[model samples]
Target: MPKISNQNLFDALLDSWDRNNTILVNLLQAFSHGGLEIRAMEGGPSIAELFTHMHYCRLIFVLEDAPECARPINRQEWASEQDPSVLARLLNESAAAVREAVKSRVEAGQDMLVHYDHPILMLQHMIWHEGYHHGQIKLALKLAGRPFSDDEAGLITWDVWMNKT
Candidate 1:
């Protein structure tokens, strides 16, 4: 891809969030309400917790570093919703808030607490952070005995998140 604008980069990160979130939703859809809290591993978070963590991280960053742009996110989304689609919608809303936070800082010539001096790096940080947790989520699903495939892996691939002609 040619050099993408910072706005486009944030948009791509949002795309990545949505794509991975769909796979996470698909995995969770296989389980019952109680099943979302299952953790076959001893120490890791449950599927629901991991999903909540994803949104919480986004919420915290906006609250601490970019309060001016925190209005769009609903921070009280730590609890599990019965519908994965509902959870995905809330997560998307949180991500939109974070994106606006980054946009606000960039427009105001302010620095992010994450990547000093460059506001766009906040988007980079979130893209990587969410992807990291998503990998953990994949493992959590596997440990919970959910099957995986290349189709699911494709969700997190950069090419899938990239804009096309």
Candidate 2:
């Protein structure tokens, strides 16, 4: 594909990630440390675990998909959501790494390290994966009676994530 094409694909993927971040930030802002620990169910991960795993998932994408991208070992020694600031910071950092890895893979074109891969597919998987968990976050907040606005809920809609074109 052409450079512009790669850029456009990257733009769309990043936009999706941005919406995911916006929604998660709004959800987290509604909670305290204790609230983040509330699991929506006994079998499911808590809100904090969800966020932690989400960050790790992004890191895994880069590790599995883009050999050229460099990132440190992001240890999950503690539940990140216990500290709001730490959770927010780690999420942003991991998300940015995801963007960089995807961008690098796209720019490298055929030289990208996979024999049967495209960054778009990886990005799509990331977005869809987060989206599946986003609903859990929303439910966890609702179950806790954590306050949020319709605006925040709506921000994750396709219009916001897809309109940057």
Candidate 3:
């Protein structure tokens, strides 16, 4: 097996973060046009609820807390419609928070340690979770007969950032 250098691993993680951010921004933009209905599955959370949940989860990771298991699981029966602009703002804030956390870890010389319950893991899991929800959002868009694009998905290739040496 080929050995991976610390710098390479950190770079890969950073790239993943960037790609995840791009996907999230695209999803938020898609939701902004006001055609898709964000609803939870089988009494689950609505799209807005999921977005808020993602934001809060990012905050928890930034504060270096353990990752919470499972989402709220129940929809707010009479939740108000979330503003697309607010969602966008939250996305930007969360991205910035993750980036800052990464920077701090690097500066503190703690990025090389393999932590089982590390904040980096939380951030990575949030990105993966976001991607999963984004897929669900795309499916909903298709079922609603709404137009969507894969421009952001194209921005997710690992090679783009990996070759930045």
Candidate 4:
């Protein structure tokens, strides 16, 4: 495979994070009003809680690893029923904070030890965690009889990765 320059590699990583954030916000926005109350299973976290938890997880890492990026992210009580749009905004903000924290660490050649992992691992963790939650969100919608069409789901999750609108 052809090798990419360091800057290109970093940009790719940052773009991936941005796409992740976009997918997440789009998924949440796709929900109808009150769809946030949907849950994947009985007694499981609602869609709102899932979104909130994702943002909370990001904050935990940023607060510990990059306090400067933590200011814009307000701390919310876990699993609270805040508005979905509000959660989306917070998620975007937190994602930007994560991007900054990771970028600074990589550029300065500094090691960030969060949960015994480096910045790259931390970003991987966040992406994996959010993707898992995205599945849960979709499942919740389906369980509530409001599932997205195949095209919609594909666009939100897969096409976003390809940088397609």
Candidate 1 lDDT tens digits, 6-61: 65865665565556544444555455444666664876576677777777777878
The candidate that achieves the highest lDDT relative to the unseen native structure: 4
| Cα-based TM-score, every candidate | 0.71, 0.75, 0.65, 0.87
Writing each residue's lDDT as its tens digit, candidate 2 over 1-165 gives 566675475566677767777666555665554577877878778888988888787776677667567477466733445776678888788777777877777676743355326666666777778789878877877777774467755654545555665
Q: Model 3: per-residue lDDT, tens digit, 17-47? A: 8767766765666666574345534565666
- Which residue ranges in model 2 land beyond 4 Å of their true spot? 1-10, 32-34, 75-80, 111-116, 147-152, 155-165
Model 3 compared with the native: what TM-score?
Answer: 0.65
- List the candidate numbers ranked by lDDT, top first: 4, 2, 1, 3
Candidate 3 at 59: error in angstroms? 0.8
Candidate 3: segments with Cα more than 4 A from true spot: 1-9, 40-42, 66-81, 110-119, 147-165
State in Å the error of residue 152, model 2. Answer: 4.8
lDDT of 4 by residue, 1-165 (tens): 556776588788888888889899988768646777777888788778888888888888878886766655446636666587787778888898889888888778777755635677678888899888888777777877887888988877789897543
* Most TM-score-accurate candidate: 4
**Local distance difference test, each candidate:** 0.65, 0.69, 0.60, 0.79
Candidate 4 Cα lDDT to native: 0.79
Candidate 1 local Cα displacement, residue 116, angstroms: 3.7
Predict model 3's lDDT versus the native: 0.60
